[model samples]
Target: MHYSFSKDFFWGAATSATQSEGRVEGDRKGENIWDYASKEYNHRFFDGVTTEQTSRFYEDYQEDIQKMADLSFNSFRTSISWSRLIPDGVGEVNPEAVVFYNQMLDELNAKGIQPFINLYHFDMPMKLQEIGGFENREVIQAYKKYAETCFELFGDKVAYWFTFNEPMIPAEAGYLHDRHYPYVVDFKRAAQVLHHIVLCHCEAIKSFREGGYSGKIGIIMDVIPVYPRSQHPADLYAAEMADLFYTKSLNDVILKGFYPEEIGEILRKYDQLPVVTTADKELLSATKIDLLGINYYRPRRVKARESVPNPEGVFSPEWFYDNYEMPGRRMNTSRGIEIYPKGLYDIAKKIQNEYGNIDWFVSENGIGIQDEEQYLQDDMVQDDYRIEFLEEHLSWLHQAMEEGSNCLGYHMWTFVDCWSWINAFKNRYGFYRMNLETGEKTVKKSGLWFKDVIENQGFDKNN
Candidate 1:
């Protein structure tokens, strides 16, 4: 069966500046949190693989973008580094960054690929982190200015602007858990950081609207659909709580312009609620996005809490519901995430039914292979697993669109096997596999298949 899409559908992949633009110290580009952290706390990353080195898109973007065109991508999403743009995070826009971003955006447009620019992708300025990162309310105004700078500079070349990519991630990985920088394990700090990020997002939206940039601005959320382990009331309730915390906490504010009552109730119950002053509430209520970006990679399975938390114990998301390891669940061990295609469809239906069917897209969705090197055949990574992953997920997505979903397009997690924070290059997820040893990228078998999909507007599952 051939799954089809609209003639104007967007076809591309997403990447970030910190991961691909590997020029951290030159051209007056300010040191970002990753640059500072990788050097200061190098032991934290996998095999000490710091972010200082990765896909050198800074030098090779023209060629890389031409490659994107060759692969038939009509649209592409990437981010501008906050520190690189404003060296100090608050003042003095970097002149070199202006040149680089302008040229890059012009190149993308020249190649007939629409550019989706995100302001932040967890690459905070070291200066900001030194003060307080997202926890400091003052940083909100600074980010607002930085966002406005991007608008004034690049608005003519780009039409899609996203405020943040996966805001919940930094809240979880940085504060509640130790996956990313700051590595603090405080739930209260996480709440503060998350609330502050929402404020920052709204502030940027205000700037975009007030600046009158001829473009759409939104936030990219990692919307992990939560599922109950079973049909029992306990499991269902647990799933609901997980959804409220992981999914709705940000989606509601971005889409519906308000936080859910259940989120406040649980946060208040645990004394974990962040400050939501009258002014903050007013800003949130006043802000609304033109669209949204959905990055769905996995689903969360949960059951009712099996044990009680000690009063002295640290509060966390897991406190509300215990993670349930669903029996015989399909797993992508390399990334330690479940390979659940149905989750995408569930998320599509969720946006349709719960959120007034807002326009959105699969901003990031792909599998990662830790040992991708072993799959090399005839000097190309024969990533049939990735091909299958894309097909299954795209099939379900097509089904959702057939059922009246407002999904606009699909973008894979990345165009090249770019660097990930702590994992470094452990798991590769891209149509073009970058050889870390030589900075050379070779197209995978999937790239050839994806090019055909783009030209044909869809895919034939039977092939």
Candidate 2:
């Protein structure tokens, strides 16, 4: 297939501030939710412990940037840790962090890799968490302050800015799903958290605008397309509900300047509609994104499970959307999501046909493997499967671009294997292998393949 993307297409990888940067519990940097949660649940990580080196991006960003350059990436996405930048999430900026981040930006730019800086990526300062994290409205103001600080400091070097990375996950995972820090399994709290996060995103956008920084700013959402099981009406409705809850909930606020009707209905049904202030709507309406960064992983399959009364004896939005697994659907190795390449096309179409014509980037798309070294043979992981995965997704993206989707680039989930929470150090979704036992890193076969893809601007299937 002659799958050619834009000539100016950006190709790179993504990493977060907390997962890869392992100064988790430094007093100088202030504590984050990850640092505390890692200690509290040390036994859950795939590496069997929490407090250890992860990719060592914090200590060796310069070398890693060099590695990224070696892989032929023209763009690199990373986050500025809120705690590391401002320990209290509000006070004086850390001089060390400023020096470090500036050095990183300079290094990447020197190597012709454009830096895409994100403000937050699941690393809320502990001091803010003490005051209820995203659940509290005051945190939104603090986030605005944080965004303004970042713009004032790094605006000169970085042109692409994202307000939040997968903000919905933290709201749902932490407040509703019991999988993350401040694990409260209450639907009311979940809605509250979701509301506050959306507002924070809007506030951040407003901050970037009002701070007199004229550059592209948007939010990065990890959106999983929802597919129904067959032609069943219940299944289709359930999928729609899931899409609204997961994807549209943020898109409506960011793109449409209001929440979806389904959201309001669910909130009214559960009597959990947040008490929105007059300023909240104003802030949301005032702030609009110049672009959107979509992190597509997989699609959700729904078939309408039997209605079980809220067993937790607590209110939940799930009452509106039941969990259902379609039989005979293609599932990911993660076993939780389905691998649907067409979903990327569907998302791009939706964005173009519905959300107006806004520029977008495939901010994070990758597969998780059991082990990076498992596929290794003679110093390289012959990860043809990963190459296939990317090829299929990019084909869909290419079709989208051909049909007029304003897609700018594709950045994989990560550049190197880094530690994750609870299931930390388990899944390897990096182009490079990182050995924790020995501070060594090596490029995998996928990295070599990605190097060519970036160099060629698309995959040469015939080759």
Query: Quick one: best lDDT, which candidate?
Result: 1
User: How do all models score by TM-score?
Assistant: 0.98, 0.96
lDDT of each: 0.91, 0.83
Tell me the tens digit of each residue's lDDT in model 2 across 251-295: 888898888887888779667787777888887788789879999
**lDDT by residue for model 1 over 133-247, one digit each (tens)?**
9999899999999998999989999999999999998899999878888888999899999999999999999989988889798889998899898899989988988988888
Q: Give the TM-score of candidate 2.
A: 0.96
Candidate 2 residue-pair clash tally: 0
Deviating ranges (above 4 Å) for candidate 1: none
